[model samples]
Target: MIEVKEIEKKYGRKKILKGVSFTANKGEITCLIGLNGVGKTTILNAIMALTPINKGQILIDGEPLKEKTFEKITFIPDAITMLPQMKIAEAMEFMKDFYTCWNQDRATELLGFFRLNKDDRISSLSKGNTAKVNLLLGLALDVDYVLMDEPFSGIDMFSREEIANVFTSHLIENRGVIITTHEIGDIEHLIDKVVLIDNGLVTKEFNAEEARENEGKSVIDVMREVYIG
Candidate 1:
């Protein structure tokens, strides 16, 4: 499990995350839902230690965040991390050389799953294909947790559907996943927990199933109450 307690962050004088807190458990998908610039990505960055925090604690399976702990958690940012000029195969080799946990078989499988060609240049691929490559790079890693920032953003409908299919597939099973996105419809059924954020604060956290079966609410319904009402 990953626990984030009272995290605070600022960029110069502008506050990004103000008292953000949440927990992501193993074998479940925890989603951070909010509008753009509400610090959703900042919260994920804090969890990965990619961005410095002003105040807070982040724990992974009861241990404080550290270099070794990072090995067990994979973070895929929204932007393309790989060099634009690099080919897909070269990017695979780069990941293999850097991370001890890199799995060649899994990478190969995802390459086929995403219908991506090894010889294809990252810069030459379409926007949707580029997103798939980004996703494949992260999902191929052998890790206990995955943190994704806007995996569904800026993609075509078919690409979005393909990516969402991955959630139900064995690729993501039994691994704790924390995804931040404002587009909730595509993944509404796959997520186990939803943490709603607004104005740099976590406004609500609840189990998705309980919200439907017990409270009779869909994710969008809850969103309307939180953001609209």
Candidate 2:
């Protein structure tokens, strides 16, 4: 499980996260939802310790994040970081050399799962396939938790659907996932918990299935009430 407790963050005088807290249990997909600059990305960054928090704590599986903890978790940023000139197979090699946790067989499986050719150059791949490669690199890591920032952004609908399918597939089974996106239309069925953030604070947090079963509220239904009412 990934636990974020009362986290506070500041950029100069601007506070980004104000007393934010949430829990993402293993085998569940937790989504952090908000509009632009509402501190959704900041929370992911804080969890990975890419940015320091001002106060409070973040823990993974009951322990605070440490250098060794990185082996147990991986972060897939909003965009790919590798050089665009590299071929897909070469890119996989890069991961193998860099990360001891890289699983070649699993990467090969994901390569097929995404319907991508190993020989295709990154620069020539479609936006959707590029995103798949980015995700595959992270997912191929033998880790327990995955943090994805806007996996569906800037992609075609079919591509977004393909990405969403991975959440339900055996590839990600039993692995904890925390994803961030401004829009929830594509992944409404894939998420287990929704944490809504506004004005740099958590406005609401609820189980998606519970909300529907008990209140007859869809994610958008609840969002409409939170943001509009």
Top of the candidates by lDDT: 2
RMSD of each: 1.0, 1.2
Candidate 1 deviant stretches above 4 angstroms: none
* lDDT over C-alpha atoms for residue 114 of model 1: 88
Candidate 2 Cα deviation (angstroms), residue 91? 1.8
- TM-score of predicted structure 1: 0.97
Model 1, range 35-103, lDDT digits (tens) per residue?
A: 999999888888888888999899999988888876799999887789999999999999999888899
Candidate no. 2 TM-score: 0.96
Tell me the TM-score of each prediction against the true structure.
0.97, 0.96
